[model samples]
Target: MTTYTLNQENLNAISERVSTPKYNRTQLTTGIVHIGIGGFHRAHEAFYTDQLLHDTSITNWAICGVALLPHDTKIYQTLKAQDGLYTLMVKEFDGSLSKRVIGAITELLFAPEDPSKVIEKIASPEVKIVTLTITEGGYNYNEATGAFDDKNPSILYDIAHPTQPKTVFGYLTQALKLRQQKGLKGITIQSCDNIQGNGDMTKQMLLSYVKLADPALIPWIEQRVAFPNSMVDRITPATTAADIEQLKTEEGIVDAWPVVCEPFKQWVIEDQFSNGRPLWEVVGAQFVKDVEPYEKMKLSLLNAGHSVLGILGALVGYTTIDEAVNDKNIHAFLEHYLKQEVVPTLSDLENVDLEAYIASLLQRFGNVSIKDQIDRICSESSAKFPIFILPTVKANLKLSRQTELAAFVVAAWAIYSLGTNEKDEHLNIKDALKDTLHKQAELASQNHPEYFLEIESVFGNLKTSKPFVDAYVKAYKTITKEGVIIAVQNINLSQINSI
Candidate 1:
């Protein structure tokens, strides 16, 4: 019988002889608690933490992984089974692959299983920095207003009993409360999600929660916590059975929990740690005075670009980004959209070449081995579109020109909401807006494209802008009548020339 867990002997053997040199494990003097332990965290932040672990100078940065949802119990079990040993598969084009075993994680905790355990861990004096990848929706903000929805029952509960509620913000609030009561030094809360101004957003949500729960703690938290903005990128695909088989075949050891990612990775962080931080610069993490421009460039371009391909790929019946990007029409559509429509709106793109970045993004998209799924990318459109795509459209329209590429994205989303693809089959519409999308689709069929814009939470203040509304309506009409292929081919670029 084949074993599922990697025994200590196997782990030691693999660690000692793995092709990629294992970095020295930092001694555990201090703790870095990471919430939302998922594939992306394992593939991205943990990978960086592993690098820091290898650097002997940083001996205090140990990671204690926490999962809030019950489903995460399985992941916790898997990681525990292997003694927190997992292989990270770095995939490249031309069929090149490298596998490395990551071992930076020191312990795992489940929030629902033991909420007090989570609180104690977060409140511990040993824990200095708290990083999160709780996803876009995990913030539990109002989808329509893009603000903290105090009305949410969970939020309400957290307010009433701050320490007991099992939410990320609640956990942070309670932990901060403990810190205040104990006179312990404050910990930095680093947000690793793709939301624009993620750190600030996290702070706002936490502070808002605090205001309703314990107004007295507000000043203390404001004085202590440092919510530093950061920009992180990596293409870590969900693991599949084939990936497991490949690992077993290549390494001669069974790895139940392995992470797969594209070769491309980038992390830009603001150097604003409150308690302390790792010497991540030694492992290629860029620390800067201000990460705003970089964050905007990434959130608006790379993330927005991914959304475009994701929706377009679904329409074209392609599963992975590589499949969609390889199509000449899709590639051209994305290039024109990013270069002509998206890049021009950003006033502070810095010294980076926009054209080169788009080209490199396309190259990354075309990497078949990366296997980034369009469905995965499109999973949370309601949360993603407003943050990633709509901002660019608004910026482009404010310049007094309608961006056809931006319009294309809006239209593509509308078509995607229709509940069927070009193949006339049900397209799995995974989003918080699923129930209402069909209604919106019905409105679109009636040539009322503004119905989609009326989604106040996602479109926000931009829905009232005449230029944006008109252009979006026109694009929606075009897609509804002529379809995505012809609509994309016929976008008028000259309409958005003047600022």
Candidate 2:
């Protein structure tokens, strides 16, 4: 087997080994500065940008990927070493693999290594778009107040040291300030995260941050910057050592940080930009006036469906998402939840077949090649629940619909957070709210399931709703008493009596 490194020079040698960029890599310039350039970005946005780059005319739309956190140092070094080249392998449902070297990222920057450089690059007139995939928790949003978390330590630090900032909001604000001072045009701050009204939320958080840190810039930002709502979907799992070795053995290419995901991909963006934007629509990216319906549909069905399987799968000792989805009981539960409790909450979406979408999601989840970890799906669930599942659950409650399965999803999470499964095995809790959730879960274990719902931010007013509370408690008790497998097999919509 011939060994090769993934880089510009090695492209010719590795053409058959993997899909290399066809165009002149040197001609590509940074027009987009994407923050939080993780697996999903590489798999989705970068993937789309790579396709668009096939057009000889689309030279300036290349990405200068930015990694802000200290933890992202590995990826920064990996991408930097590889000359911004990395392999992306899409695993199809039939077990075939499609491999390509993503070259949309022309450069990589580690903000922690050089904050000033990041701020300067973001302020560059060449960069028309600033994108983020900083995850739901990274926004520092206080859902209760519907504002950016001013009390957060990082936000507070950024507030005090206005110019020498640390957080994402700080970096963005500082850059915008420089751009304004230079009399340069404003840029679009696009969020590709899996949140409802992601663009609106990005605007809200940025504006709030600017208002608190530097009120003078608020007007300029409000007038100039555009935050386009977008709905991005893909199932890129965390990279593992096995994945690394597999790529080397299969493709004969060494990539320090490669991305693997299912073949399915979707991006629906609101066509609002401060400056000229990429012709991404030519490459399968949908630009629309409203992304809210699409957003709701994806969040409610696909995302919430993942959560249900994630929590329940972990409880039932299923490690990967596919394993859980392949299980007859788990698959049935997901199908039922999507068709019964989830779909009713979503209003009509144009050109969308909701039933077919749900069917596809189940099929996607069952794709064995992807190997998306159930633990990964359940990770940051504290942030996930309010954004993904809670909205649909709330909508169902408002409609006087039975949310037994939805409520069960919540109970599954609560039980899973107890730090043990039905078999008394240790369970990993990966949430910012872990300690608090564990304490609440401990109380719920003592036959006080309502205690879990008392976390007002997560459960909201649903904690006080008698019917929801009752359904959740009953579900919690059934899982606790009969074991997860028994509870799962016993789940039936017909058995759920209305409160």
Candidate 3:
């Protein structure tokens, strides 16, 4: 067994089972600076860019990954050591797997190591795009006020000392300032996060930050920058130890931070960028005039569906998405929720088959080889609910639609937050709102369910509505008394009424 550590040196020696870059890696140069180099970006965006790079003519769209936080330190080191190469394993529904070495990332920068260098790279005339996968929570958004969090410690620090900054907002701000000072053109700040209006949100947040910290740059930014909304999709799981082991044994490739994703992928962009299009449509991206409809549809059905399985599945002792969605009753519950509670709100989309999309979501969620973790789906859920599930839930409530399924999912989240499953097994809950939700969950468990809904930012004013509150409390109690499987098995959700 001849195993090669994934790097520029091993590129030629990689097994015939794995695909390596066909073009000259030396010709590829970074024109895209993407922040938050998580598994999804590697699996989705970088994968697409790598595919697009197959045409040697498109060499400048290579990615320079920017890891901004302490957690990103590992990936930064791994990618830097590998010469921005990582093996991508694409798993299909029937359990088939294909591997490729994604060389679209030509450089990796840890911002904490030197923020100034990141700014310098972004300010370079060759770089015309800065992208982000900073999850919904990373926006530093206050949903209640519908604005960027002005008083956030990092935002404030960035405001005070624009030269040395902490957050993405600051890094972007300082970089643009450097560009502006040097008479360099603005870079399009595209956001590929799960947020509904991601590009718009990126623009709004940056504008708000600039108003507070660098008001003078506002006029220049308004004229030069482009923040195009986009809808990106791929079921990429965090690489587990098993994945690393499998890659090493099967393909003879030792990758430090390899990426694993389902074969399904989609990217819909608004066709607005200061930089010319990367011709990504050739590689299967939809460059459209509008991305909102796509965003709303995918977020409501796919993302919301993941949350349904993630929260409910966790409560039922299911550890991965396939295990949960593959279960007969839970699968039925998911279909019922999508067809009944989630579909009605997606009126904005045209020419799209909603039913087909729902069916595809089920297939994506049940991709066994991907082994997408329930904990990964549930992680950062506090930020996800507002972007993914709540809009559909709220829209249904406004129309007086049946929200029992959605309510049950939320109730399951409340129970799942308790850090213990029905089997008394410890649930490794990973949410920024864990502590607060746990406290609220305790209160809700003790008879005041509205206390949990009191977080106006997350749940909104849903606490004030009697019908929603009653449905929520009843579902919460049903999960508590009857357990999660029994609760989800009730497709009509009659079990919730038993309380």
User: What ranking emerges by TM-score with the best candidate at the front?
Assistant: 2, 3, 1
TM-score of each: 0.94, 0.98, 0.97
lDDT of 2: 0.89
Question: How many clashes in candidate 2?
Answer: 0
Model 1: how far residue 94 lies from native, Å: 2.8
Per residue, candidate 2 scores C-alpha lDDT tens digits across 66-109 of: 99999999889989999999999889989998888988999889
Query: Which residue pairs overlap in candidate 3's backbone?
Result: none
Candidate 1, poorest ten consecutive residues by summed lDDT: 490-499
Better of 1 and 3 by TM-score: 3
Global lDDT of each candidate: 0.81, 0.89, 0.86
Global fold similarity of model 3 (TM-score) = 0.97
Best of the two (1, 2) by TM-score: 2
Residue range 124-182, candidate 3, lDDT tens digits: 99998998998888999976557788888988888888888899989988889889999
RMSD of each: 2.5, 1.6, 2.1
Shift in Å, residue 346, candidate 1: 1.8
Q: How close is candidate 1 to the true structure, as a TM-score?
A: 0.94
